[model samples]
Target: MLSHLEFSGFYFIKNLHFGELGFVQSAQGFIFLSGLLVGLIFMKRHERAGAAQVRRRLWGRALELYGWHIGILLAILALSRLMPDSWFVWNRWLGRLYDGGDVYVAAAAALLYQPSYMDILPQYMAYLLVSPLLIQLIATGRAAWVMAGSAACWLAVQLGAHMPLVALLDGLWMGGATLQPRAAFNPLAWQVIFVSGLVAGALAARGELQPRRLLDPQRPMLFHLAVGGLVFFLAWRMAITTGLIAPEVLERFQAYENRVEFGLVFLLNFVALGYAVAWLLVAGQRSASYGLRVGATLLNRLLSHPFLVLIGGYSLQVFAWHVVAVYLLRLVDWHVGPLAEPLNSLLAVAAIASLALPARWLASRAPTRLADAPQPSRS
Candidate 1:
């Protein structure tokens, strides 16, 4: 949400771009973690119930996401129509919707015309739609095959195979409009992260993978390497952001850092950072070192705060609301131009605080049976 606010021109803190902090951004984590949780929860569901239940639940989730996508787009369209086009500063993606007429609307409804920040939900929908098949493979002890296929798909995308596929699909349906290939994030390239998480979660669910083993005191080398890689990436990011590095030098590395394709740098950084954090948390609870234990306790407490937990519990609702908040903030920027300090920072914090509204509302109205249902362990 903070990242979205920053992207929407809310400079909550000067020179602090949350989205640009390192090689990997929150979106990668979000996608990977979502896949992880889905894999863990639904695999358990499949075991207890059956494949039918998994299909039903996952398809229902896809439908809910589809509804939210269309509803959000409609809300944005309504707001755009109500505001004067000359006065509003529209993002290029949203602007295409305003100008492209009904064809764009139809395309968006079909999930082929995702617009900027609005794209991720559609990607999630696609993943959820195919999740049953993925889950079946994982459950049947073919997870290695599934992972290999996912990696192959990601590699194919990196080699530019997805481009022609997108072009072909567009040609079949878009006439000459050229919108199908314009998604902000390519699912093909990004699925590797999701599948990696899925396989790990499935293994963890089945007692084949013990996450706590990541903190084994004997693995000091792994811990040290993770810390070293994290520090290097942090320094590299700081250099670029703080102008300590030459632009041309950074430009040469841009290909490996491509956000659209889920580049190599991001994959490596996420792995290192993820392992370090996991080890820290696991060690915080079970480590022999007192100082490390105390530090981990503090970190865990901060992460597990009730307010954060509430937002996490209704993550989908919060995510949807965040997108709405971002678009609405853009509308505000359209009228006021760029906001000055204090005001900008104030609005930014308030926008983040407002994310809890949907979560709270949903919590209040949550069905009793659903609320009481057994949840998968975060451990």
Candidate 2:
């Protein structure tokens, strides 16, 4: 959700600009964690219910995501129709839908056309659709092969193998309306992160990987290395963002840190940060140092706050609502012009706070809302 806020140009807290802090973004963590939770939860389900049941459940989730995607698109289309022509003219993303006519709508419904802030769901749907197979491979002791295949896909994407397929689909379906690719997040490249988390979660589920042992404070070598890497990346990020680095150098760095491709720098930074965090969390409970323990406790409490947990528990609903909020906020910006200072901050706060509405609604209907129920295991 912080990611959607960042994308929407809402920096409610200027000092803590999370989006600018690293080579990686929240989307990577979101996708990775989603895959992790799926692996952790569904693998156990697979064991109890068998592969057929697991496939049914995962595909059902994809269907749910599909409903949200189509529903949001329909809502946006309705708004475009009801709003003034100038509104669509101001928003090229919305304008393209009308410009391309029913063909574009069909493409969107078919998940081939995704507008800004609306692409992630399609990628997630793709992941969920294939997760059963990947999980099955892992369950059947071919986890290494699954990882290798995922890495190969990512490598192929890095080598530009995915573009031809995207181009083919666009040419076949979009006609001459526009020449741009539909997806912002390339699932082929991003699957490496997801599959990594999935494999980790599956291993942890089967007791092949123990979190405590992996993060044990006694083994300080890897943790120290992780800290060093985190510091280096953080310093580099600060240098670029603060203009401490020259513009030419920054441009080159940016070129290499492609988010769509899940560039090498991002993958490295994410790994470093992940290890550092895990170590900190583990040390919080097991460390001899009182200060470290206290600090970690506070951080954990802040993260595990009821409101945040509420938003997390109903992640899909909150995510869909966030996309809608971003679009609605963009529409407001187009009409009212850019909001300044505290107003923008307040708007950001309001928008983030509004996510609770859907969460609360889902919570209220929890007894019957099996789709929105909390997963068996989430970390």
Output the number of the TM-score-best candidate: 1
Q: How large is the C-alpha RMSD of every model relative to the true structure? A: 4.8, 4.9
- Candidate 1 wrongly placed segments (more than 4 Å): 6-18, 85-87, 91-93, 246-248, 288-291, 366-379
**How big is the positional error of residue 345 in model 2, measured in Å on the Cα after superposition?**
1.0
Model 1: pairs clashing at backbone N, Cα or C within 3 Å: none
Give one digit per residue, the lDDT tens place, for model 1 in 30-63: 8999889988998899899989999999999999
10 residues in a row with least lDDT, candidate 2? 1-10
For candidate 1, what is the TM-score?
A: 0.90
Clash numbers, per candidate: 0, 0
Model 1, position 116: C-alpha lDDT score:
64
lDDT, candidate 2, at 34: 88
lDDT of 2 at 215: 77
